[model samples]
Target: MTDQYAVLGNPVTHSRSPFIHACFARQQHQRMEYRAIEAPLDGFESCVSQFLQGDGKGVNVTVPFKEQAWRLAACRTPRAELAGAVNTLWRDESGQLWGDNTDGIGLVTDLTQNVQVKLEGARILMLGAGGAVRGVIQPLLDAGCSQLFIANRTAEKAQLLVEQFAPLLPEGVLLQGGGYTSVPSDGEFDLIINGTSASLSGDLPPVNPVIVGAHTLCYDMMYSARPTAFCQWAITHQAARAVDGLGMLVEQAAEAFLCWRGVRPDTAPVISLLRQSLA
Candidate 1:
């Protein structure tokens, strides 16, 4: 039988993961079945356990279940440990369940490789302090970002991330967190990433244009056929580039594919195909 993989979440019907993975498997000539399984909010644990114990080879957890998946795993990679969540899971031959967070690496890979953004010595302003933001902080730091200031609606939540990630900061790198008003008056940024879901509702985060310069790249973690509100704002402010997270989504799935299949898929073609579909 072909190996099975899936993304498990509540409200998973909206996920593009199955289509993307199907593209990947086809492109690589691999025999695998990937799908999305919607588990009841309270039934994530049981659903995941049942899948892994039976015929499922691996699963990708999303949204509300990532934390629960993290807790349920018998072993976790360091990145997942720091993230306090898990987006990918598999069981080894010995039956030990393994968890990992590929979000950060996926984002970093997309920015550096696909978007051609420079991370070393770059000043970044990240909007949001939630789980999506948390999973990607360390990878950004590791990518040699000179400064990362996280802005959120609630200042304390942002500060907690700053304190928690302080130890992992590369020497001479600066990391700070605060409310929207606390964003530095510093002239402009090399990059600005919006991690909030405001775009799904056609709302833009309360960000000032002062943070975006002609050299800045504005990236929204949400993807749509039309420009997201945040991306529109960035373009209106004359930022160098305004893009969505479709590439990140494809790249992350590629990382998960590599984890389960032991071979990486070429993401450029998949990304192009996905963009065309969105259009």
Candidate 2:
């Protein structure tokens, strides 16, 4: 029988995961069936339990359910433990659930490999201190950025994140956090990553244009058919490049697929296909 997998989200119909995973299965010749599961807002645990009991091999958790899934897991990868959220889930031989968060590695891969942006020794600015931002901090630090600054509406939240991840910083790497208005003006950043949900509502973070220089790459962790507000803002500020999170989405899914199937599917073609579909 084909292995069964799915993506669980509250508003799951909008997820491109099933299609992306289908492409992976075909590329790797894996006998698998993937689908989108709309778990009720308060019914995530029960829904996941039912799926696993039905012989489901794995499922990608998203949005409000990631934290719940993290709590439900019998074991978690180091990254997932730091993130305090779980986006990928599967069962071990003993039927113990394992959880992992691929969002950070996905963002790092897309930026360094796909976009060819050098993260090492580069000054980076991350906007927002929510779960999306939390999931990526360790990986970004692991990438060897010389400086990483996080700015959020709630200054305390951003500070908390900085405190939480400070011990992981490598020598010579600086990590700071503050409110949007408190973003440093001493110098420009090489990269500015928008991890906020502002773009989903057509809003842009209150970052100063001075933070973006001609060589800065602005990345919004949100993708849409058209340019996102943050992308347009970056363009207007004359930044070097403004990219959406589509590549990150595909890359993260590829990582999850590898975890479940032990085969890494080539992501370039899948990214191209998804981009074309978006266009």
C-alpha lDDT values of all predictions: 0.93, 0.94
> Best by lDDT, which number?
2
- Segments of candidate 1 deviating more than 4 angstroms: none
TM-score of each: 0.98, 0.99
Which residue runs of candidate 2 sit more than 4 Å off their true CA positions? none
How do the residues 150-269 of candidate 2 rate in per-residue lDDT, one tens digit apiece? 999999999999999988788999999999998998888999999999887877888889888989999999999998999999999999999999999999999999899998899999
Clashes of each: 0, 0
RMSD of each: 0.8, 0.7
